[model samples]
Target: MPNPSSTSSPYPLPEEIRNLLADVETFVADTLRGENLSKKAKEKRESLIKKIKDVKSIYLQDFQDKGDTEDGEEYDDPFAGPPDTVSLASERYDKDDEAHSEGNQFPPIAAQDLPFVLKAGYLEKRRKDHSFLGFEWQKRWCALSKTVFYYYGSDKDKQQKGEFSIDGYNVRMNNTLRKDGKKDCCFEISAPDKRIYQFTAASPKDAEEWVQQLNFVLQDMGSDVIPEDDDERGELYDDVDHPLPTSSPPASSQPIDDEIYEELPEEEEDNVPAQVEEQRKMNQD
Candidate 1:
């Protein structure tokens, strides 16, 4: 017979058949427990026992067949497939090759004749040691294609303006000024010291190096590059007014009036000493 808890049957027994089977099972149980029967009469109970066993066997076979059908269906399904593999080494190599190729594509710029012009306005804005001068060198290279311009000025007025432009192997000072005094017409390369550095060819590729060297010199002098405009100067000063917050509350928001001391009553002051004396007496007792 199939276990009652087993889920092997695809269908249920008819109500009439179920009732008949239940009655047979009850009769078999009763027969086994009855003590009034003689030994010979108990042996004749085999026919009734066989009928109960047959009913259970039929139900059990049906349940087993249903279970087998379900298992077969699961195996026949075709959606399942194998997992995939990935190549970590190939991916890493591709990334490395890309980085190496990018590095080789660009050439370096030379220190001499850095091709660009530094705007006096821009240099003043940076106001940090070497940064202003470095920007000046970078600007010079950016402005003049492949030609480099050299500047001459005192440490105080690095933006005071005089520079010379060097293109290819040729070197010349730019000293032309506008008649209206509005702008400088020429670039300055050399100073009154007459110290002449050898003229060299520079490409856009060499801009970073030239700027670095110029910045180094400015840092050694211990001066910052300040902005040339009044508005830019004001911006630095404005920052001082708005400092970062701390744990203390803002002074303006505090309740100053609440902390002011009020006059005390004479009666209350007189009673204070009497109360203290009474408390001392109680403690002594």
Candidate 2:
């Protein structure tokens, strides 16, 4: 039998193919945040990651819709009535004590603790840092529950990295670029306490979809407000030409030493521009 905790498609996949997919998914999830890879490697990695996510999303939706395994076998519920009780006389006398003990041990679910996902996917969130990167935008597996926004390092991560209540928060498209570099397709969530959480989507359409979903939930919760216009987003909303430096440091920024230039291998030196352009296009995509 397949592990119940593992994600499985409603349509049966060959064991070899399924294992290969799982390995690729694990590799992509584990290496996505690493910055040590070459530009070409990074581009390929991101592309593979996107494909994996798309496949996972499709399979998950199908699994939910089908609501059964391909084998068509019915699985027994473990929560069904017990086959037998320990003792009828002991149970009669201890039922009240057991109930009281359970009540004290487990509290009722809170009103704000809705754990079902309304929307979920990958998104990059800006976080402060004191390192050379200055500020970093890191990708996370994000989910929006009823009144909470939760994030994890990966979709398969059991423990959440963090979460916040969005009861009175407002979400809007705010495409402001940071001091480090430009980030397009961005949005901001303004908390009731004046804290702002920023996130960048893979595309403008995606960013708008996230904003719309959040707006719908907020409106239902009595936050009646409209998303801000593009002009209000930021000064850099339309400025897409200039982006962060990629591949390697520009020649002007390099040390003015002839020996450094002479030491560069001919093959590596010639491919820098092409590599940079490839990375640029990947980022734009």
- CA lDDT of every candidate: 0.34, 0.56
User: How far off is residue 160 in model 2, in Å?
Assistant: 0.3
Segments in model 1 whose C-alpha atoms lie over 4 Å from true places: 1-12, 61-285
What's each prediction's TM-score?
0.17, 0.38
Across 63-136, the per-residue lDDT of candidate 2 in tens digits comes to 33333322231211111222111111112222233343222222323223437878888887655321121123
Clashing pairs for predicted structure model 2, backbone only: none
Mark the regions of model 2 whose C-alpha exceeds 4 Å error after superposition: 1-114, 178-182, 223-285
Evaluate residue 27 in candidate 2 and report its C-alpha lDDT on the 0 to 100 scale: 45
What does the lDDT come to for candidate 1?
Answer: 0.34
